[model samples]
Target chain A: MRILVTVKHVPDLQSQRSFTGGRVTRTADDGTMNELDEHAVEAALQLVEAAGEGEVYALTVGGADAVVAVRKALQLGVQHAIHVSDDAIADSDVFGTAKVMAAAVRKVQDEAPLDLVITGMAALDGLTSMLPTALAAELDWSQATLASAVSVAGGEVTVERHLADAHETVVAPLPAVVSVTDEANKPRYPNFKLIMAARKAPVALWSLADLGVDPASVGREGARTVVVDASPAPPRENRVTVTDTGDGGTQLADFLIEKGLA
Target chain B: MTTVAVLIDHRDGEVTRPALEALTLARSLGTPVAVWLGSVPSADAVALVGDYGATEVRVVDAEMRLAGHAAAALGAALEDADVVVVISTFVTKEIVTRLAMATGAGVVVDAAGAEIVDGRVETVQTVFAATWNVRTRIHTERAIVGIRPNTTQAVPADTPGDAVIVPVTVDRPATRERVVAVEPVERGAGVPLAEAPVVVSGGRGTGGDYALVTELAELLGGAVGASRDATDEGWISHEHMVGQTGTTVTPALYVAAGISGAVHHRGGMQASGTIVCINLDPDAPIFEISDFGVVGSLFDVIPQAIARIREHRAG
Candidate 1:
């Protein structure tokens, strides 16, 4: 089995986040591998282990700082790391990003036929949950998303997809794109040996030219939707906080009644 | 006026609140057309669509439980639409993505609302975990927009629509995926979380005992929600989780019980109209955004609140 897991470098959830130029401001200092992608990395690693003879490739797209994402993937034992970075790749929308990802996947396929592509259900920073589908569409591969449980056998990938009303077991052909939810598995922590080796690991750096994806077809110029305005939400007014003096609940009820919210 | 297609979401022959909400939003954009995928809709369902100002109901009889298949069937009905609107859900987002890919339309998901600004679809959404409001315009002719539930209030049209029924047929694309089996999940009695006007959620503070949280929700006729902490602890099903990556709720009243209101938790419910919190720790971040906050154990405060509500009803 040969699998490529897409990872992202994202602002830590605990840190303050803001948007500049109508895009998320990314600084090298405070970013880490997206928390959710760990589950994707775990899924890919587990699948490789189950097959007993396979390769797991972790790939990311960003500027120089995004190498950290693939390095973190290496700490979890991915055999290869590739970072696709370019000056022209900034401000890319989901479609633009998907185009870049499809190119990178094809480059890897050139090395050897890849059996599967895995990604987290959603990126922590964007939370758009659109890339897996768009990438599959770009690659014209079968897509299975939001998988709570996944298994591969006989060139077919099966996933237990959870929905609002029902749980569905979906089956798709190999060379497909799959996105796994956090419920798929408990991500394993990086051990001391793996963490040390990750520091010295070699990462393959690619550009839009390397993947043959047009620079004009990605980045801000290729974006189909443009953010016109962005601003912070104004704070709520007339906030009242009360300490419990044995009547806190009554006070809450009175407040609710006053607002007709009870 | 351009055609604005609203994908009607229904189950068991009844329409969901979000679908009506989508139609309500659609009416503002242009000629509202309701797209129904599956067997023929019941008369009441068709009327409900018209009541919300859908000028036409185009039913595509097919099996679309899987998004990959649904996207293919949906593409045909959307050919004439300038904008495609659907209630943003896990399944529908993928469907919208495929539709956009097929038609070369710009797409936006998790949007709060969409409007035609100067002959193009402009979408308003809360991003960066609901801390920021963003306005984005689609550059393409057809825009696939996925609006979150409960963001727009559903109002019937001034003059009810003359919903002309149109049957649509499209060759189902040879999709690469198929659903082999489906199992229904049982949910507790209450309003669905996404559409509930009042949401009462518990967290680590509940200590695995949701009796009080569930009681408070039941008292208010609200849905019971959970912080990622509680859901991760297996205290509640993932469906009940209210967080950034989980279910985002914009209820009229959101009551956080024992949740510390991390950015993840806050992103989901901060858009609510009224916020209240009960936490033993006075310093919990949830208090910052709350209109009313009580520094006390949820166990004690919830029972008291529930009792007062029951008493208020009796009086």
Candidate 2:
């Protein structure tokens, strides 16, 4: 049961996030592993540990700051880490990113085949939820996404997906892409032993050349869509905040009734 | 005029609100063509779509709930179409992304509005957890867009059509993943959160007691909602969670009680028409976005508000 878990580096949700040149601004200190991707790391570790004889690898694609993401994964007990970085990788859309990731997975598979690729339901920064499907299509592999619970046995993986309308049990063959939701499991806190080991571990860094990807086919040049304009939406008008008094609740009722919303 | 394919989402023989909203949006771009997947559309469903400006309804029988097969079928059915529109849900985003990748079409999801400006698809959407609004353009020959619900008004056509139903047969590619079993999740009483005109939500300040929150919602004829903190603490089921990853709703009136308004929670309800909040801390971020806010304990504020509303109704 060789598994690879994909992680992303995103700005902390509490921070004042802004865009630079129509792209999300990222700084080394203000970033961490995407909150949702921790669930994917947890899923991969659980699948390998349960098998009793397998390895879990963590992979991330971004700038130098993205190394933090894979390192965070290592603190959770992943054995190997890989970071794919290049100047041309910046400003790439989901398709371009997926293409770069698929190439790196193939290179890893060449040395030793991986049976699964686990990912978060979506990267919180974008919240597009398109990467898992794009990565599956790029690798021509099966995809079972938005899984609330997952288990693997008999050369197959099954996942339970909870959608708006139904709870579905879905099955796919080996070498499949699976995305787990926050409901999948509670992510474990980093262990002191693993944290010490992860600090000294060497991470393999790869570029577009190492992954056999064209530089021009990625980055902004390869983007399918273009951002024509970006600006903050105007703030709400005439906001009112008052300290509670005896009449506070009555004031609330009067406002709602005045607006005919009650 | 260019052809626009609108994916009509239907359940229990009724067309969903977002699909109708998509049709209303589609008419602004070009001719509206309704694409119905899975269960066949009933006569009433067809009539409703036709009244909303869809002249033709194409029915395809297959397990479209799965994204892969749906993508393959859509690829074949939309060879002549120039633009595709669907509701921005988790499953539909995947389905359209696959089609967009296969056909070299640019894709956008969670868009508030999309239009064909100067022969290109341009869209406006909220970013950074709904704090900023950004506009994007699709430079590809074809485009796919996932529109959010409650963002557009459904309008009737000046002249209705027959909405002629045409059966489509396409050799959809075989998918490796298969749905083995399915169970319907039971819905709670009153209106569903997404469609409710008024929503009253609680957070950690409630201390796991939903009695007052439920009372306020019931009094306003609204649905109950819970912040991620409340849901995580088992105060409410996951179905009632409202956040970026959970349910995103745009009700007419949104009331938050005891919620500190994290960025995740704000994204779900920031676009609501009228916002009101009750929290112990006046400096909570939720107060910044609230149209009306009261700084007090929810326990005291909600019960009193409910009583006052009842008095107003009686008077």
Candidate 3:
């Protein structure tokens, strides 16, 4: 079995992010490596390891920073790394990003047909969580989102989903796309040897032209939705009425009463 | 008439709240049509859609298929629908997203609110982990929107609208993946995080002791929440994690204990109606946005608060 995992690089949530005149700016404090993508990479690693005789390829689209994300995937257990790079590919919205990724995946599949494609359920930076869906549409594949557990065998894939009210178990055939949730598994730390190897590994860089992608149909221009304006929400009034005081019973009751009823 | 597709979310034949919210939003976008995929529409489900101004209710027999399989059928009917307003749960997001792409329509997710702006439907999204609110206008031929539940109240219209059952075409793709089985979670553990009115969250400062947080939540009849640090450290379950990388909650009241109020953490619960903080550090960031704050340790404050709640109950 061959597995393909999509990874992304974004300002790490731990880092402080600020926008200067509508553009997001980041600093060293902001960590990177699209956190959710880690879950995807981890899932791929576990699946390949479980198969015992399979290959896992990590793919991403970005700039030099993206190489770091791809390298991290290698360290985590991907046998190879494919990083699609182009000046035109930077800063694309969800729709455009999905298009570029689809193109990359198509090129990879040409060389190595993937039995399964895994991605993080959502990127914390965009929070749009639309890429997996868009990619499935472009590739015309079945999709399972928010998968908590996935096991593939006999050309069939079984998934456990974390639903709003309950858990749902689903079984689908192979050659499908699955977006993993954080609950799926904890991402493993890359070993030092693999990290060193990742540093030395040659990351395959493909441009839009190299991938045979039509720039006009796959970037910012092709986006169906565009942000008009973004602003801070209106300030909320401060209504801090402390209720838990030293008094055990009366004060608690009084606090509730002051808010409305006693 | 424009066919507006509404994904009816249900469990055990009972329609979920967010699905009704989507139905309400669908009415404003076009001629409302409710599409039930997994099971036959119960009388109760049909009535809910009828009350919400759905002109038609389309039910596809698909309890045995993978979740995404039924979406193909709905997408065909919605190929010409002016708009599709899907309840944006994790399940529906993937299905509706595929439908949106297949139909070549514009897709928007986590839409908190929507309206016809300048003759085009415009929607608001909580972007950058709720740090920024963005409004986008949909100018495409078809609009696919994922609306956040509870953001808009679902008030069924007084007048019952016309209902029609249309034939839905299902094209099962030759996919290798299928759902083998489903195991429902235990019941009545606590309020569903999304629907809970009050949430009591603990952070790294709890030191792996959730006993107090649980006690406080039980007293208030709320759900227990955790920061990413707690979940990452294995001190609490990931289900309790609430942050930029975790669940986004908008409860009526949110209580933070032993939390430093990291920016990522704030992104999750900032939308709450009221925020109260209990931290040992007077300078903790959680206090900045908190409506009420106590400068003390959890060891001191939580016990006192729980004791007070019991006292009130006894008195």
Candidate 4:
């Protein structure tokens, strides 16, 4: 079995993000692979490890810095890495980004077919949670997004999807795609030994042309939506009251009575 | 006309309020068509389609009934549609993404609004967890989108029309996974979270005591919310949990008692129109975003607030 994992490099969402003149300003802050993408990568690595005979490939699209994200996946024991890089790929929204990724996956599969394609349910930056579905649409494959758990055996892929109100168990045939949620599994941090090994691992960098994609076919231009504005959320006002500590239950009852709610 | 497919989720025969919100949004996009899966809904449900501005309604036979994967039904219903609009629920997101994948459509999840732009559907999104706003215009042959709840106020109409019910065939792919069981937790008698104008939440300071929170919620004619810590401690059911891992609520008024205002908790409730925090420590994190801050114990503050509410109501 062959597995493909899609990873993304996003600004560390933990840090405060500011914009200047309708564009996001870069911070001198440290960043890492998206946390959700890490979960997807870890899940793919786990499945490959359990199967013991399948190959895992890391795929990412971004600037030269995205190679760092691809290497992180290699450190987790993926067999190889594919970095889709180009200046033309910048500012791609979830829709356009997924289109580029789908093209890359098709190119890779043209050489070696895959049993499964995996991605994080969403990235924290935009938190659109649309990539997996958009890619699934482009690939014309069965999809299970927000996968809480996934298992592969024989030629079938089974997934437990976490829903708004309940859990759904679904099974799609081989060559299916899944978008993993945070609840799937915690991502592993690379140890010094694995990091050293990853340095020697093969990470093929491909431009959009190498993947046979037209330069005009993707990125922000391909996106359906453009952000026109961003501003700090409105600050809330406070109107709270303090209660006496003694006899809280009775006070609570009295408070309800005073409020005319009891 | 741009065919806008509206995915409706119903209980028995009643449409969920959020679905109605989606219908209201779908109307803004193009010709709104309502799609019902599983059992055919009641006449009231059909009536609601017309009332909410749905020009057509299609019913598809679902092999795995009881609110199964909405994407599957939506995918089947998109036989002749230009765009699809599904309500953003935890379940619908999973289905819409999958269906969008199989159909080669541009998929945008959790859009706040939509409009026709340059002969295409443009959607406004709340990105970066509501930190940034974006507008997307889809020029694809087909598009799939999900919309947030309460983004649009549902305007009920009196136009009576019939749903063009269509029977869709089911193609159950042979697979090993099976639906073991379906269990429902009784949502007990209270104002629905989406409909409630106010919400009162408790956190670690409550020490697992929710009596005051409930009282304040009732006083405000709202719902009770719990911090992740309180929910994890079993002080309240997980359904009441309000934080990063919990439900995001945007009510007209939100009151926090004993909560220390963890960012995770604030992420879910920060969108509320107004926020009030009551804590012994004035420096608690909750106070930073609160419109009204009272430095005191939850025990003392909640009761007094309740009393004031009663006094105002009586007058």
Among these predictions, the greatest TM-score belongs to 1
The residue ranges of model 2 lying beyond 4 angstroms of the native Cα positions read B218-221, B310-315
Q: Model 4, B223: alpha-carbon shift in Å?
A: 4.1
lDDT digits (tens) for residues A170-190 of candidate 3: 665667778898879989998
* lDDT tens digits, residue span B241-276, model 2: 888888888888999999999988997889888999
In CAPRI terms, model 2 is classed as medium
Candidate that would win on DockQ: 1
RMSD per candidate (Å) reads 1.3, 1.9, 4.0, 4.5
lDDT of 4 by residue, B1-315 (tens): 877888886764678777787777777777788888777777778888878888677887664322225556667777888888876655666566567556667666767788777776777765544555666666667887777666677776456456656667767543323454445545646655544567889999899988888877876778899888887689987668775445767676777888988766876777666677778886787777776666777777677666755665687
lDDT of 1 by residue, B1-315 (tens): 789899998877889888989988998898899999989998888888898998789989866676767887788887788889998887888888888877889999989998898889999998766778999999888888999888999999999976778999988778878889999878777768988889999999999899888888888889999999998899998889998777889998999999999988888888888999999999999999999999998878888888888888799
Candidates 2 and 4 compared by DockQ, better number: 2
Q: Whole-model Cα lDDT per candidate?
A: 0.90, 0.89, 0.74, 0.72
Q: Lowest lDDT 10-mer window, candidate 2 chain A?
A: A16-25
Query: What range of 10 consecutive residues in model 4 chain B has the weakest lDDT sum?
Result: B62-71
Better of 1 and 2 by TM-score: 1
Error of 2 at B73 (Å): 2.9
lDDT per residue (tens digit) for residues A49-148 in model 2 = 8998899889999999999999999999899999999999998888999999999899999989999999999888889999999999999999999999
Instruction: Write down the TM-score of model 4's second chain.
Output: 0.89
Error of 1 at B179 (Å): 1.2
DockQ numbers for every candidate? 0.80, 0.73, 0.42, 0.29
| Runs off by more than 4 Å, candidate 1 | none
lDDT of 4 by residue, A1-262 (tens): 7899998776676667655554454332445677678888889988888897788889988887777778888887788899999988776766567778888898889888998899987665656566776677677676666777989887877887645455567676778788887668878988888889999988888988888777776776765445555676544433444434554434444444443335
TM-score of chain A of 3: 0.87
In CAPRI terms, model 1 is classed as medium
